[model samples]
Structures are given as C-alpha cells and as structure tokens.
Target: MTALTIRPLQPGETDLFLSYPFPRQPELWESQRDYVALLAAKAYRPEHTWVAIRDGVVVARACWWTGPEDKRPYSLDWLEAEPGPGQVELGTALLRKAHETMRNDEGRKPDYHLFLPPGWRDDAMVRVAAEARLQTARNVDLALFVERYSYRWSAEQDGLPDRSDRLEFRPADDAQMLVVLRQVLDGSLDAHDQRSVAEHGLDRAAELQLEGLYWFPSPRDWWQLAYTGSGELVGVIIPARNYDMPTIGYIGVVPSQRGHGYGAELLAEMAWRLNDHAPGEAVGADTDFSNVPMVKAFARTGFRITEEHLVLTDTAAGK
Candidate 1:
C-alpha cells in the first residue's frame, strides 16, 4: 500500500502542475505560455492550485479560478484524477487538503461548477470525467446543488424574441431596484437565491444577486422594472454582458405576479433590449432546470439549448 502526496504548486511551477497523468476532455486550458498569461491576468494562482502525487507521478490535480479583478479564488471548477485504484480517494484527499487551506484564507470554500456538453451521459468519456469530479466533491462534503439549463438566441438563426406588448419597462435606480429584487425572492425558484434567502435572508439575498449582476460589463441602467397598463409592477429584467457573451442577466417576477406568463414576457423584453445593443450578435441566458416556466419561456422566446452548467456547492458555505 502507498500514500498519495498532496501539495500546491510553488510559484512558477506551471509545468509541474500540468504533469498530471490524464488528458482533459474538451481540453480547454493552459499551454505553458497561456498559463503564464492567466497568472498575469489574475485568473489563476499557483498556490491556489493543488495536486496529488505518488512515486513522483502526479495522479490528481485541482485548480481554482477567480474573476479578473478578484484577488481570491471564486470557484474550484476544474479537477482531474488518473483513473485507477484509490483514484476517488486520492482526488478527494487532494481537494480536501486544498480546501482546508483555502477556507482558512477566504473564510469559505468556493463551489464546484462543472460544465458538461448536452447529453453528456450519453458520451462515455465525458460521463467518466464528470462522475469522477462529482464524487470527489461529495467526498469533500459538497452537495449537488442544481443543474442550470443554458439557452442561447442568435439573431442570424433563431431571430429576436418578441417585444413585450403587455408590459411597459422603465429603468430603476439602485435604491428603487432593491425593492423589486427583494420582492422577487419571496417565493423564488432559483436555487442560488433560495439558498441565499435561507442563509442570508431576503434583503441580503437580493443584495447578493444584485452584487453579482454588477460584475458584468453591461451598464447598470439597462436593468428595467416591468409594469402593466395601470402602473402595477410585474417584474425586473436585465440585459447585460459578461466577459464572454451578451446575456439576459437577471429576470424575476415578484411573488404576487408569478402566474400570468410574466417570466416569458421578461425574457422577451431582455432579448429585445440586448439585441438592440449587441445587434447581430448571439445572446445567452440561464435558469435552474427546476424552474419549468422559465425553461418554457426560453423556448417561446426563440432560444435553443446550448449547454448546461452543473453547479455544486458546499453545505458549510452558502451562495
């Protein structure tokens, strides 16, 4: 019997971190030079990435990443382990060891978010890779939080979503916006929001969601609160963009107004507004798969399934 060794990469040990003995499916990261650039961009740091080695060979590696302006890691999203005996235990130990240090530094462990292609379970290679990481996460006390369904609309293919006819939208300032943001969380279908509401309460939950929406590059004023013919509030919609693509950032209906197909109305209005800004460009949006109405709304708005994001979170850490 042998024990696997766990440790973080020392500064400038890019190659050593890359020495793990398995090929990544979808293979979306780091050549040595590109990794150097990511370090420079503050997207990744050596000490935040960890690996497990036995007999001088790397068997498992876990990487944490941050937003462009963030100094601390935001998510532990990439993980890999060689397939063999004790592989699961080795990977679990590796993640637990890295998380122990990270939690002490950041006051919490970041969630594990893994992206899978559509119909991933049908693909042998992808399923194995996904399962290995998922099992490791559970072993480390993380739970399967939710599966977010991703939808995209292309002006060139799917065309624009229908403009809202029943609702009039007007921009809300930060203070006024907080009102609707809080109201929408009353009976929210969003798992992240539910968790935030459970742990942080309603006001803080809305504030947290608003805080995340601000991280996008889109103008803050693009957020609009929708109202009916008589000036009654319906919901809120945000047409925004991230570093990657144009997006329908946030769309929520207040608890009192959930049943009138307003979610789809908000989705359509967001698409129209975003298309106006990013003309001829594709737009992306996501909602929890459990939110059936929102999922149907994406279909009604001419969006198609592109990919799904599998979000995993720690029970010990909320949001």
Candidate 2:
C-alpha cells in the first residue's frame, strides 16, 4: 500500500478540483462548482487549496478563503474526504497539513465554518459525518468554538414589536459606539467576540469587532445607539447590509440594562431600522446556540431559524 501524500492544489488544477465527486452529495455539484469558481476568481490561490492523494488518486481536499479586501486567509471553508476505510485518518492528515502550511509559530488557525441543514442532528449519518469532520480538525488543534443558528426575517413575518417609543434611537458617533461596545463586552453572548476579548485585551477585541462590521453595505449613519428619554444609555443596535442583504450586524444591551426585556426591544428596533433602509428586503441575524435569551429575543422579533452552522477555531484562541 502506498503512503498518503498531502499537498495543495497545483496551478491549473481548478477544473480537476471542481470535477471531483464530493463524497456523497452528487446533487450539490452544480452549486459547489459555481462557488468554487467564485472563490478562485476572487481570493483563491494554489497554496490556499489542498488535496490528499494515495497512489496518485485524490482522496481528500480542503481550501481556505478570505474576504475580497482581506490580505490573508480568514477561514478554512471546505474539507471533504472519501468515506472509506481509514477515512478519518486521511481527513485528519489533510487538515493537519493545511494548518501547518497556513498557521505561523503563534498557532493561529483560521476560523472554519460549516453550514448544515436544520434537523441534521436527527439523521444518524449526518451527525456522524459532522462529528468526524469536527474531530478531524480537533486532531489538528482546532476546537469547536461556537455554534450559531442562522435566522431570517421577511416583511411577511410579524411586524416589529412596539416598545417604549420614548426610548430614543439615534445615530451614535464612533466614540459613543466604542464606549457602548466596551460596556457590553463582558457579558456578551457572542462566543467569537467574547473569545476575542478574553485572548486579546478589550481594545484589540473591539478593533476586530469593528473590522468585521466594516464589511456592511450600510453606511455609518445606519449604526445606532439607543438611549432613554433622560439620556441614559440603554444599548446599541447595528443594522447594516452584509454582502448584499440587510442584516443585524450587532445588537446588545448594556450589562446593567439587561434582563429588562431590552434585548428584544433592541432587535425590534434593528428590524425596523433595516426595513426603513431597504424596504421590502429580507433581514438576517445569527445568534449563538448557547445564548438562549438572545435566541428567544430573535424569535420574538419574528426572525426564524433558517440554518445552523458550526464554527471552529484554534484551541489557543479560546484560552
């Protein structure tokens, strides 16, 4: 038996990669092809896509990607291996090789995102495959950092809830926004942002959070701060466009102001703001699965779970 050989996809191998059968999902080939092409045309490079071969047969493949303006890879988005004897071992080896090639001495592994359909947990094969993939990445020192339920809201859903109209909603300047972000950082249910605050100080974490929001299509004026009639800070809601659609970029209530049903109010305010900006367009939001309160808040605001995702990152990042 020939030993496995793992390496990145070479130049001019996009066609080969696209043609490879993706384990079990034959119906998704067309969509996957289009996505792979888009990535290649944007941030994809030979070194960012990897494949594992045994006796010259491709057995596993993986790829990393970045946003259009990003200078380096941001995440590992694709990993698939043939399901056969020793499949787990091959998948683990492939992921390990990719991490070694991409990560530096700091052991910074790019975030890995996996989207699964709703109710995947009930399907035995689906659950097993998902667990195997996660464990494979874990073998390479990446851990499951967070799981988020993707939610969507349309104008057809329940109209935005009405709370205290006296609670003023106003556009916040950068300074004020940063202050609010800092105040809510400690008790934030956002696993990624909380982990960022823990690993790097609040300042660095805030910078990263702001960096992510910069991708929104909505302008700065769309970012808002909510306060009381007496000028007390209630919370902040960032309703902006992501990619092409309107989204609740971030919404949080001040730690001292939580538990007063402020979170649902904030989400409602965000939905109203986005509706005003892009009338008749759908709005989207994601909440960590562990954050039951926020999830319920989203539900109360008419956002339904549309999908679920598993996000993995370097284990050290969680420390």
Candidate 3:
C-alpha cells in the first residue's frame, strides 16, 4: 500500500492540479481558472488546496476558497479522485486535514464548505461531522440548461408585459446605481441572493445563494436598470454571460417593486441582450432550490432545471 500525505501546494505544483482535465466540460473548467485568476487579481489568498501523492503520483485532490476580508473562511469548491483503490479515502483524508489545518490557523476560525454530488449526502465525512456535533449549513444550486428543456423567451413575457404607459429602461450610472443597489440590499437578503458582509456575529446565510452570481466578472454595461418615468428606480438586471458559456448572472428587484411584474421583464431583457450580443448553442443560469419564486420566474421565462448542486458549509472552532 502506498502512503499519502496532505500538504500545501508548492509554487510549481499548479500544473499537476489536474482536478479539471481536458475531456470533461472544458469550458466550465477553464472558467474556474478564469475565476481563480479574478480572485487573485482581487487579492484573495490561495489557500485550502491539498494533494495526496503516492509514489510521486498525485492520485487525489481537494480544495476550498475564501471570500473577501476573510469572510466565509473555507468554502469547498472542487473535489475529485483519479480512478483506483482507496480513492475515496485518499480524497476524504485530504479534505479533513485541509479543514483541520485551516481551523488551527491563527488568522481566523473560518467556516469550511463543500459541494458534492447528491449521492455523497451519506458519505462518512458527513457522518463524522454529525458525530462531532459540528455546525452544518445546507443550500442548493439549481441549474438551467438547454439539453434537457426547451426554452422560449420574448421581451413581452408575463412579468414585463409591455408597460407602455409608466416606465422607461436605461443603463444606470455608478451613483444612481449605488442607490438602486442599496435598495436591493434588503430585498437581496430577503430573496436569499446576497452575501453576508457583516462580521463578528452569527452571520446570516441569506446571501449564500447569490455569491456566484455576484462573483461573476461581468462588466457594468451588461447591467440594466428599470425606472419610473419620474426617475424612481424600480428594478435592476445583471445580465452577465458565463466565462465558459452563454448565460446570465444575478438579477434582482426591490421588494417595493416585486408585484409590478418587473422580475420577468428583467429576465426577458437579459435573454434578449444575451441573444443579441453573444449568440451560442445554448444558455444557462442557476438558482437556489429553496428560492421557488426565483426558480418559477426563470421557468416562466423559459428556463428549466437541468442539474442540481449543493453548497455545504462547516464551521470550525477558532484556535
């Protein structure tokens, strides 16, 4: 039997980080690289990665990520094992070690999180956590893809059905945009689509679902704002294309504006812009499974659930 050890990655070991390989969904894989690059550019430290090498061969991999200002200390993003005996043990060992080490770090006691295929819901690691009485957080990652569902969209969908009498649409400037975003902060949390920016207390998990949507590297021009004729901002749409494929990112409406059918309008407009700017074979978007209104809104705009994902969080005691 070959022995395995978990340790921090050396500077030159980036090439052996073959958790993402060529033949398997290259675009999304490349997008992960792009996302890592973006985080580095934003000054995110590269931590929470470990490799299990046996006889000079890297047979398993596990990794996590942290957000700005060290919030959400450990977020597990990817985990994989090359086929072989004891692969799961190797991978799971690396995961436990990585979390344990991060918990002991002096800087902060951050939360550890992982996303696994639904089948792993009963994995031993989960059982260990239960036995240890560790805090656990759960959320879903809903998927929309063209492969399994037909889509139909138009500017005149049920949500934004041609309000010819009262409102105008325009690209918002930074100052005006901030005001609109501030209004959205409350609604954002209410919708479970924002991140917890607060520190030093029990952090609300409301924004957990919105993390990916907000993290995307979409330019400002891709965002659109809807306003009343008198200039009262009602809603906003962040129509970002995925780095890997044709897709839309976060879209939100203020609570004060929800019943006006603005949500569907924003989705349709975003789809229209995506169709106009970057035509592709298909488009994709994701939502939290618990977020029924948002999911239903997407479905009304012709999106269907294609895959399911989970965002798991584990809180480690501070050293």
Candidate 4:
C-alpha cells in the first residue's frame, strides 16, 4: 500500500488541482468550477488549499476562503475526495490535515459549511453519504451545530397575507435595534444565537448580532421595529437585500411576547415590505429546524422550504 502524502497546494498548481478526474456525482462540475474560480479571483492563499496524494496522484482536496472584503480566513468552503476503495479514509485524513494547518495559534478551528438536500436524512444512500462526510469532519473536531431549513417566497408561490392593521412597523435606528436585539437574546430558539450565548455568553452573542446587522448592505430604512396597536414592542423584522435579492435577514419576537401569534404577523409584515419594495423578486429566509414556532410562522407567510443545510463549526459543542 502506498503511503498518503497530505500537503498544501503548491504554487502554480491550479491546473493540477483542477485536472484530477474526481467523480462529480453529488456536485455538478460547473458548480465546482465556479468555486475554484471564486477562490482564484479572491486570491485564496496556497496554504488555505490542501491536497492528499498517493503514488504521486492527487486523491483528495479541501480549501478555505475569507469573508467578502476581509483578509482573515472565515470558513472551510470546499472539500472532495476521489471515489475509490479508500476514498473515505483519504478524505478524512485530508480534512484533518487541512484543519491542523489552518488553526490559529489560539487553537480555534475554522467554521465549515455544507449544504445537503432536504431529504438526505430519509433516503438511505444519502443518509449514508451524509454520515460519512460528517464523521470525516468529526475526525478534525468539526461537529454539527445546527441544521437550517432554507425557505423562499415569491409572488408566484402564494399571495401574501393581508397586512394586519393591528401591527405597526416603524423604522428603528441602530440604538433602538440593539435594544430589541437584547430582548430577543433571552431564551432565543435560533440555533446559531443559542449556541453563541451558551458558549460565549449573552453579551458576546449580542455583539456578534449587532456587528452582522451593522454591516448589512441594505439601508437602515429596511429595518423595522414591530409594535402593537397600543405601541407595545412585539418584535423586530429586518428585511434586507443580500447582494441583489431581498431577504428576511432577522425576525424575532421578544421572549415575554412570544406565542401570542406575533411571529406570523412579523413574518407577514416582512414579506409585505419586500414585495412592495421589489414587486416580484423572491424573498428568502432560513430558520433552525428545531425552531418549530418560527418554521410554522414562515409557512403562514407563504414561504416554502426550498433547501436544507448542515452547518458545521469547530467550536466545541455547547462549550
């Protein structure tokens, strides 16, 4: 048996990386090509791309990328191994080696993202493949933190529910938004935020939320504070544009006001706002699978589940 060599992609090895005739069964070759092109355009560092070789033949590969306009690496974006008798082992070893090479001095593991079909859990073959991938990730200490269900609502899906006259949405400044965010942080069901609060504490979690919202490309007018007829704050809705399409970035009802049917109303208001802003473009949103209340709210607002994602992170499970 030939020993496997795990190392970073060498300079000018783009052609070599793209030449490996890896099976593209699960992923379209075009999509894979686009990813490689994106990495190249973004000037992805050679150290961030890794490969596994056996008998001088590339067997597996992985890569990472930084956030838009940011230099530090943000996520592990792509990973694949040629299908063969020992593909699983090769893939797992390649991933582990990549993680080791990329970890910060503080021992923080980079977050990795993977999108899977919604039915992967029920189908036996998909389940097996998904599990193998997950197990390989676990070998490098990346564990599944959350499963997010992707939803999108277009004018064609179903007519938006009539706006409730009882609910009024008023533009909120950053200060006001932060106040609302603090309220929603208490006992939040959002898997990402929940984990953030558990591992890093409430203040840090809130800080991250504020930072994300502050950097949102949409105008401040797109953010709103939902209030009842009597002017009591019910929740907040952030309908912002991602790149080009409008998206329901964040919507949450305060813990004290939850379960009073405010979630559906908040979501409906967001959809109405986006439709009025763009008329016909699709509005997208994602919610943690465990967040049943929010999921039902999305359904009520005419949002359909279009995709599912498995979000894996290097953070220790629940701290």
What TM-score against the true fold does each predicted structure earn?
0.87, 0.86, 0.59, 0.85
Ranking by TM-score: 1, 2, 4, 3
Q: Mind giving the per-residue lDDT tens digits that candidate 3 earns over 35-70?
A: 356345433234555677777777666555554444
Quantify all predictions' global Cα lDDT against the true fold: 0.80, 0.76, 0.51, 0.76
- Among all candidates shown, the one with the greatest lDDT: 1
Top-scoring candidate (TM-score): 1
- Candidate 1 lDDT, tens digit per residue, 1-319? 5777899889878888767667556622221125566667777788878888888888888778777766678888667787766668888889878886766233778878777777888888778767877888888888888998777897788877667788998988888889999999888888888888998999888888888888887788898899998899998988899766799888899888888888888887887777789888889888898998888888888888877688887777522
- Candidate 1's TM-score: 0.87
TM-score of 4: 0.85
lDDT winner, 1 or 4: 1
What's the lDDT for residue 263 in model 2? 86
| lDDT computed for candidate 2 | 0.76
Candidate number that wins on TM-score, 1 or 4: 1
Question: For candidate 2, what is the TM-score?
Answer: 0.86
lDDT of 4: 0.76
> In candidate 2, which residue ranges exceed 4 Å CA deviation?
25-33, 40-46, 104-107, 156-164, 215-217, 316-319
Candidate 4, poorest ten consecutive residues by summed lDDT? 24-33
**Residue pairs that clash (backbone atoms under 3 angstroms), model 1:** none
For model 2, give the RMSD to the true fold.
3.3
lDDT by residue for model 4 (6-92), tens: 998777787766766765546322234465556656636666778888887888877776545655566775777776556678888
